[model samples]
Every structure is written in C-alpha cells, then in structure tokens.
Target chain A: MNALRNAALVAVVAVAIVLQAVVLRYVSVDGVVPNLALVLVVVVAVSRGSQFAAVFGFGAGLLLDLAPPADHVAGRWALALVVVGYLAGRVRQDARESPVASVLLVGAMSFVGTSVFALSGVLLQDGALPVDLTLRVLAISVLWDLMLAPFVVPPLLRLVDRLGSDEVAAARPVSLARTS
Target chain B: MRRRRFGQGPTHDGSRRVLGLLVLAALTVITLDARAGDGSPIDPARAAVGSLFGPVESTTAAVTRPFADAISSFRTNKSLRGDVATLAAENSRLRGEVSTDPLDRQRLAELDGLTRTAAETGYSLVGARVIAIGPVQSFTRSVTIDVGTSSGVTKNMTVLNNDGLVGRVVQATSSTATVLLIVDTESVVGARLGTNSEIGFLRGRGSIADSGRLDLELVDNAVVPSGGDVVVTWGSQNGVPYVAGIPIGRVESVVSSPRQSSRIAVIVPFVDFSALDVVGVVVPQGTTGDRPVISTPTGKADR
Candidate 1:
C-alpha cells in the first residue's frame, strides 16, 4: 500500500514538472503564457489537504526556480509554495464543493500569489514590469488554471484518496521519496 | 535522503514540520552566501540544469516562432497592408521629385562632406548579428552576438546599428561575443545633449519594453529639454569604442527624481532593435581585452 501510494504521488508531480518544462504558451490569451504548475500545486494542496500539498508544492517550486531564467532568492519559491500549501489546507469545506469551484479558487489564488512574487522581485531588483503586462499575466494565468482544472484536479484527488484514509498523514514520506 | 515515517500519526505540523526544517536549511544557505557574490552564479548543479534546459527552450522557441508570427498576422493584416501601400507611394514620390531648396541642398552637401572626411580615416568595420539573451539580465544587459574574437572583433570594441551606439563587446568565445548594451543600468558613456554640447554620462537603465522608454540620467537637469533633442556619445581621448559623433537616442521625456542630483530622461533609441540583423563593431585604439570592468549595478553594491 505504501509503495503504491508513493508511486501515485511521484507520478502526479513528475507529470506536472514535465508539462511545465515542455510546454510553451500552453494556454495563451493576449500573448501571455500561464504557469500551469502553480495551478496544479494549488489544486493538489487544497483537495488533497495540507501536509502533502505543502511538501509537494515546495518540491515543485524548487524545480521551477532551478530553471535558468529564474531570478528569485534561492528558496523564494519554497517559501511561496509552503504558504500556498498551508492556505490550501485551511480552506473551508463549503467552498470546495465542485471541481470547477476548486479550480476557480486555485486559479485566483495562483494569480494573487504570482502578483506578490512579482512585487517581491521588483523590490529586490531595479526594474519594474509595466502595469499592463502585470495585469495580463494575472488574467491569463487564471484562465489557464480554469482551463486545465478538468485535466488536473480529478486525477490528483483520486490519487490522494487511493493513497489512504490518512490523506494528510501518508502524504509526507512518499512525497519525499519521489522528490529525491 | 531517507523519508521519515511518522507512522500515520496525527500532527498539525505534518508538512509545516518539514517545511520549517527546509526553511531553516535554506536560511542557513542564504545567510552564508549573501556576502559571496561570484560563488552564487557558478553553482555547477544549477549550471548543469540550466544548460540542459536552455537548448530545449531554444528548440521550442524555434518551433513556436512561426506560430507566433501567424497569430500576429491574424491581428493586424489590414493595417500592415495599408502601411505597405503608403510606403510604396512615398517611395515613388521621392524618386520622381527633385528638391531645389538651397538650405536643404546645403545641409545635404555638408553631410556629404562630413561623410567623405570620415571615410578618409583608415578603420576596420566588423559586422555581426545579435542572437539570444539571458533571461535574468536586466540592469546589466548582456546580449550574444555572432561575431567573435576570430572575426577581429575583440573585447572593448563598440557595437553600432544604423541608428547609434548599441553596446561594447565585453567577452568573446570562439564563434560568439557578448555585448553590454547601452540600456544596461550599469553602463555609463560620455554623452552630449543635442546641439547644446552639454556633456554628461548617458547610463543604461535597462529595457522595460512595455514602458517604451529608456532610462537616461544626465549630469544636470537645469537645461530645458523638450522632445526631438538628440543625444550623442562624446568623443573619448582617441577614437576607438565610439567615434566623436554617433547619435544614440532622442529625448522622449525629462522628469525629476526626488533623491538624485540630475533629472532623468526617457531616451528612445534611434535603432529599432527588434529587427536588428547587422551591427558594426569598431576596434578602439587600445584594447585591454575588456578587463573585468563592472557594469554599475553589478559590483558597486558591495563596495
């Protein structure tokens, strides 16, 4: 059972990483590319509960930051993901009734999170992104999350439940293994 | 990396527990490396991953470029077609007309004389094409060009497009050379404002393409600056990286900053960089192999 659970978690995250890496303009609205990995992290974190979500989110963020173009502080992503994971864990049960609702919530959260990240980057660096580009990024990112939810959320939830009743407890050790 | 099994225990820190631990680890690394600048960029692990992914990104970009163009075409086909027609009409008109204005003819004559005089100087011109750019580059802009040391394009050579000064070559590999553009926040060049001949350093403020302005800080803001004012690089001791008069940019706007000694201006570059296919590289009189000179925003923070 533990082995199956571990494999399931690994596969989900591995797929997300590959998608983020290989795809460009995965969903385009106004020439902007939305970051789908962020959406996935939010969804998985919220639906699967916190423990698993935070760990997986941090791992994902670390990989995302490792990309050459990334300019954040070494663990900026880890910190962001950790917070998102915790936020997802604390979301009320009434709000996450349906997949579409969950996706919308996740997408909104991703947009806000990305804006915060951008602001943080600007404070650290000298240049500022134009106001329009910033807005476009948020809008397009939300659109992508909404568009990709059908594909991302159900499988994530199934995998989590299949892992065990201790949706939060069984999540840790297995995620760590896949991360390594 | 062994995973600790909590044995299905109920604990609130379930993930925060581990996250706190990771955060602690990351803080340790950041604190240790905050003072170490050079070591941060040379991380072998990070380099290996970036290199591995860079080519993949290139291939993807190459494949998607056509699609992107197609999308662009879809959005403004009519306006582009109209512009083409208007340009064709203007070209025909210029070919058919002969200007008889004495002042205009005299100005043309003087430009011709200046060109001839400039031609008398024996100088080598190296042409190159710009390639990719590092994503993280902002304040200290660096661009890769096709020309290299092999093509007589050495370090410290100035790069120019049809409009004005583009940048100076910093380093060269076998087939490629890196240039630090004038828009880089760190680059500072001696510049004269318009016909005023007011000399000051024109520094690169990095490209914020969306803003449609280049950051240029002048020595003084006391002089009234309106649009259409030209900025040129002031001649150095001996001709090399830049000649006596190369038009760099036009003043787009002038505004005051609360803390700085000078007022900053937005400079619109003469060259349309997006379509740049060729750049001229001029070898300065004495090239010191572009000694590890720091771009302003780069090394000074520590000092």
Candidate 2:
C-alpha cells in the first residue's frame, strides 16, 4: 500500500510538471504561467509532514531544473522548492484543518518560491534580471498561482487524503468519514 | 490530544535534519553545475529527462492545440476572420510565385513563405516544429524543436520562420534541439543596417512584450540611424550562427545617450517569438567533389 501511494505521488507530480511545461504556456498571460508543480509540492507538504514534502520538493525541483528549454543552472529550482516545501510543511496542521488557510499557504509559498528562485538568479547572474521586469514577473506569477489554487488544491487534497496510509486513515477518522 | 497520534508519523527533529541535508545537497549541486560550465555532469541527466518528457510534451501540445486555437479565436474573432481572408489571398499569390520558380517548386510546397525565403537567400533548410517551451520558473526565452542531429541540425545553426530570424540552436539531442530565441538576454547577433551598411551588435531584451523588440548599437557613432531603417544580419565567419542578408527587423526608435558615444536604436524583430510553430534550421550545403577546370585555347593550357 505504501509503495502504491508513493508511486501515485510520483505520477501526480510528474503529470503536474509536464502540464506546467507544455499545456500551461498556451494559457499564459504576459509570459507568466502558473507554477503548478510548486502548488503540488505545497499541497503535499500540507497533507504530509516536512520530511516527505522536502523529499518530494527536491525531486520535483530537479525535474524542473533538468527539463528541456531550461537554460539556467540545475539546482536553482531545487533549492527554492526545498525551502518552500519545508516552510509549507511547518504549517501542515493549520492548513489541513482550514481550506482558507491552505489557499493562503499556497499563495504565500508561491511568493517565497518565486522570490527564492529570483534571488538565486540575481546572485548567480544567470540572466538579465532588471528590477522592473523581475517585479512584474513576480507579481504576475503570484497572481496566476493564486488563481490556480482554488481549482487545484481541494481536489488534490482529497486525493492525497485517499492515498494516506492505513495508520493515517485510522488516526484521522473524521477525514475518512467525510470521504465515505 | 489528536496531535500525539499524528506525531507518530515523523518527529520534528527528523524532519528538520532532512531539510538541512536536502538544502545542503541542492546547494552542492548548484555549485558543481555552475563551476562545471558546459561540461557539467548534470548535462547527461538533463538530456535524459528531456528525452523522456519530449514525447509527452509533443503529444500534449498536439492534443491541446485545437482548444488553444478556439480560445484565441474567440478573443480575436473579427481580426482572425479578416486574417483568414488575407492569408488565403497571400497563399494564392505565394503559390503563383512558387510555380514561376520551377527549380524550387517541389521543395517549396511546405511552409511556402519560409521555403521561398530560404531559396531566395540560397540556403538549404530543414523544417521543424516547436515541441515545448522553456518553463516560466526560469526566465530564459528558448524553445525545443522537433529536429536535432538526426535531421542534420548542429549547434550554432540559424533558425528562422516565415517572417525572419528566430534564434540559434544551442543544444541538440538525437531527436530534439533547443533554440535560444533572439529575444533572450543572452542572445547577441551581429547586424548591418540595410541602408548604409553600418556595423552594429543587436542584443535581446529578454521579453516579447511591447512588440518583441531588440537593442541595436552601432559600432560607429557618426552615422545617425533614422526610424524605419531595415536591418539584416551582418553574417558571421562561415555563417555558423547567422547568414548575411537575412532580414532581422526595422529600427523602431533610437535612444540617444550622452555617456556613450555609440548610438542605440530599438528594433522590432520580424519573427513573432511568442507564437512560434514551424521553423527551419539553415543547414550548410556540402561541397560537391572538386572544382571544375576550364581548358585554355593557348598551347599547353597555361601549363
């Protein structure tokens, strides 16, 4: 069961990454696509604990870094997402309890994740990061992520709840009852 | 409380330790990749991932294209209808032109405008479609095309669409190649003014916003560039990156700076980097054997 759930988690993240890389570009506004992979990482963090979220974040970040058309350094996204996953997981209990808090957490983590990535770019002198352009990208990316959260988070949360271990299901009888 | 039951999952100390280890691992990978440059050990991993996801991206792009077209058509209904009429008329005109050029008729059947441009410019082209785009997580403007070394495409080859220059091939796998768009900040192409042939360097501003413009700075300060002056590639040695006489863009506006002696002009590139679909990679024609020798009428052929 654990192996099945882990495989499901990997499949979900992979699908999110592929969607973000391919399909999301068509719906982009001003070249800013929503960070769907980041949202998934945050959701995983909220449902699981920091340890699981960090591992998932690292793997997902590595995929984003290595994905084609990615010209930047390999570990920038990995670092940014690791931090996002850890921080998001710290508030797991509150986010799991309240839908509003979870949505807010997604928005906040989006900002942090983008900021971390941008800061790394600035430090590494990766590309042209003009103040105005960077700020515009940051603002628009956050808005896009927030807009995507309501539609994505709840369903993903329910799915993750279903994928939870038997021990977790036993511990959280309320969620199991709701699912039933 | 209920917290004790859930606390059995992972201890706080364990999670914190894991976070630190992962963070350290990421930083180490970043340093190694940054230091290694082109020969980074990560290249193999990147290529593997690209190959794995390449098919998925192409499939998704194909599947979603119609829905995308529908949404865009809804937004620009009137303009798109007019555009269709204009395109139909242009297609007929282009067909007429292609028929007149008997030698290029067969090859020019696909992407007529692009093939025509290549034929006129005396370049052999291999056509490819953009399979995927650079993720927004990174601010680089690049696209992965569906052609690579298998299609005779190599690094530093010029890519263009019907309008004009798109970019150059930066990386190529067997089945896919990555083209860095000319609008990327890292892109710099040598250019020549169509009017006076003033030498200059054009740099990308990294965004297609405000009409996908480029920055052109002349090597000489005396020549004043007026608005609407056409620009073409200056051509590199052996034409590895950009060939001579390919239309780049027109000077949209010039920005004069007192601190710098060189004059700067803003150019709007002909290629729409945003809606790129079919593009052609300019492949060099191979030499056919040895040069022909002419016989002289004089007694020993000038031996």
Stretch of 10 with least lDDT, candidate 1 chain B? B294-303
In candidate 2, how many Å is residue B123 off? Answer: 1.1
Which candidate tops DockQ? 2
Write one digit per residue (lDDT tens) for candidate 1, span B1-303.
Answer: 333433233546565686677666545533433335445742454445455444444455445433433333332343432132343354445433423354345445543433333244333345554444432211124555655655556556777765577777755554456677766555677888876877777765455243434666666678656777998878677655566677788988887777865777777877654333356666533322322211123222211
Where in model 1 is the C-alpha error above 4 Å? A1-32, A46-49, A89-97, A122-180, B1-11, B25-34, B77-210, B223-226, B232-248, B257-261, B270-303
How far residue A169's Cα lies from its native spot in candidate 2, in Å, is: 3.7
lDDT of 1 at A121: 46
TM-score of each: 0.57, 0.85
lDDT of 2 by residue, A1-180 (tens): 789899998888878887876766665665678898899999888777778899989988988888777778889999999999988988887777767778889999999999999899888877655888888888888887887787788888777767867665567667534422
lDDT of 2 by residue, B40-149 (tens): 89888988987777777767777866444443434333443213234334444444343333323423543777757766777767778787787545778888887767
DockQ (Cα-based) for each candidate: 0.15, 0.41
Model 2 per-residue lDDT at B250: 93
Best by TM-score: 2
Error of 1 at A115 (Å): 4.0
